[model samples]
Target chain A: MGRTSDARERILTAARTLMLSRGYSALGVAEICAAAGVPKGSFYYFFASKEELALAVVEEHWAGQRAEWTRALAGDVPPLRRLRRLYESTEAELRAGRESCGTVTGCLLGNLALELSTRTESVRERLREIFDEQVALVAETVAEARARGEVTVADTGAAARALVAQLEGRVLFAKLYDDPGRLDALWADSLALLGAEESQGAV
Target chain B: MGRTSDARERILTAARTLMLSRGYSALGVAEICAAAGVPKGSFYYFFASKEELALAVVEEHWAGQRAEWTRALAGDVPPLRRLRRLYESTEAELRAGRESCGTVTGCLLGNLALELSTRTESVRERLREIFDEQVALVAETVAEARARGEVTVADTGAAARALVAQLEGRVLFAKLYDDPGRLDALWADSLALLGAEESQGAV
Candidate 1:
């Protein structure tokens, strides 16, 4: 049982790294297996197919991202400040990516959604669920800000979706330019969209 | 010579369709030729490689897009109205895609930039030039709008980039939800971002 679990973890780790950098369609199962230093049989044992492996990776990556988001938007801070903290964390992650890989790796979910949405239904469905969850998180914060009179918007749900879209788009630019500054604009503009001033964040 | 040119045109059309729907890395040269109904030999006769073909396609697609942008942002109209026209064109295009393919096909350049930027420098450089051209077009419009007191912003360049990023991100959402409403919010919010109201257009 221990040996099987190790192989599963290795395969997941390898798939996460390779798919994030190289994209979903470009990276092959054989390449992932080789990168993980596991046998083909071991890969099959963990995940039935590449799509299945990708789904697992999406869930795992989202779990980690959700945790960071929860921390950044912790209830202790005011809503607008929490949003700023969330973007700051995003900037920090991009800097870390630049340091580690010499380039921005954008969001795996956004990348995969673009590449696989038309080609694979199962993956697309998984992406929709993840998108829904993340968008809901943003909506929750937007609602809180509205309740506290920190921001104003016609519809919190639409605003949340727009913010998420802007962030994904900004991340793409960050990857394209290989610069973290792109994210700063995203941070500022998103705050503005919510009718909040970045300078007025809570202490 | 004429036959060779015809083959090249066919290849470009097929590639433009496939690459836009799928992605840069997902579609292969063989598939492009087969879809184009041309022999593999003819594909090589016209383009040196898949990357070369993609570069050409990017240029061709952008050229068409630039022409449309020129018309939409015509100086005769008020700048804000022209910007509105540009986005309306985008919505119409998305609607057309939905009618033809039963789904949304995001911008080819944005999709390719996300997929190929880290993997291929040549493609990334081309994308940069294209982004610069498009963003310059937008900045010119924003400057015109600012001159006419149609909108207010600190930096027209940054605002233009933010708008472009928002549009690209909105396109991705259009693809993900397979709903044009996602783009509607993008249009509304982008106008809002510029400190301009969408309802106040030229008579």
Candidate 2:
């Protein structure tokens, strides 16, 4: 069972790499299998179809993001600080990825949402839930900030959506231009979008 | 020469439809030719390669957007009003498209930027230029709004970027969630981001 689980993990890891660099539609099951170093039979044993494997990949990716969100954001720090840290860490990761990949990879969920959202209903629904979960996490932090008198969030829901959208949009620009500066400029702007302090470490 | 141009236009039109419904990476040259009702030789005669044809499609699409932007946003009206009209018209188009396509197709450039930005440098550069051009147009409007006392834009460039990102982000969500309401909510949020009045037609 342990060996089986390892094979599954390898398949997923390879799919994430290939899908992130190329796209969901460009890569096939055979390529994913080759990249994973797993036999095609094992690939089928793990997942029903390419779409199912992609769904599993999305789930695994979201679980990792959920863990990071809980760690970096749901801390005892100030709400805005946690949010800023989240964006900062995301930018750092994008920078690191650029060094190896020669370009920013942007967000996997966002890239898939753009490419596969309309093409597959199951994937679209899964992505929708992931986005909702992520937005709710941000909204919760925002509501906390408002409760602590740190920010004036007229509508926490809307503010969270705006911030998340800003993050995604900035990532898209950063990758497209091959410049992370495009993302750095958005940190203060995102706080301002929520009526939070535009300066650093402002509680 | 006229017939050559007609074949070129038809090929581009077909590529746009297929790419928007499917994606840039999924569609093949033969399918594009079949959809356009043009022969393979005509495709090569009109364009050197599939990538070249995709570039032409992007240029032609941007021209249509430029025409719409100039008509809806470049008028002598109040800057904020022009912006509102632009969003309104865009929403109208999205709604119309949804009625026909069963989902929001999203902005063509934005969709391509997400899917092809990392895979191809030429497409990424073309997209970067398109984004820059669009942002400049929005920045000019923000500056005008500031000059006319319609909105207080502290950093017109940043505000324009935020607005553009917000639009793209909202489109991503709208497509993923299969809900245009997600995009409709951004209208007031975008105005608020610029510190503009949320009232109707606040000239």
Clashes of each: 0, 0
Candidate 2, A1-203: lDDT as tens digits: 99999999999999998888898999999999999999999999999999999899999999988998888797688877898888878888788888877788888999999899879889998988888888999999888889888777688888888888878888888878878878876767676677665564454
Colliding residue pairs in candidate 1:
none
How high is the TM-score of chain B in model 2?
0.94
What TM-score does candidate 2 reach? 0.95
Worst 10-residue stretch by lDDT in candidate 2 chain B?
B194-203
- Per-residue lDDT for B58-143 in model 2, tens only? 99999988888878887677778888777777777778878988888887888899899988878888998999988999898888
Error of 1 at A2 (Å): 1.4
TM-score of 1: 0.97
**lDDT by residue for model 1 over B13-60, one digit each (tens)?**
999999978888888888998999999999888889888998999989
In CAPRI terms, model 2 is classed as medium
Which parts of model 1 have CA positions greater than 4 angstroms off?
Answer: none
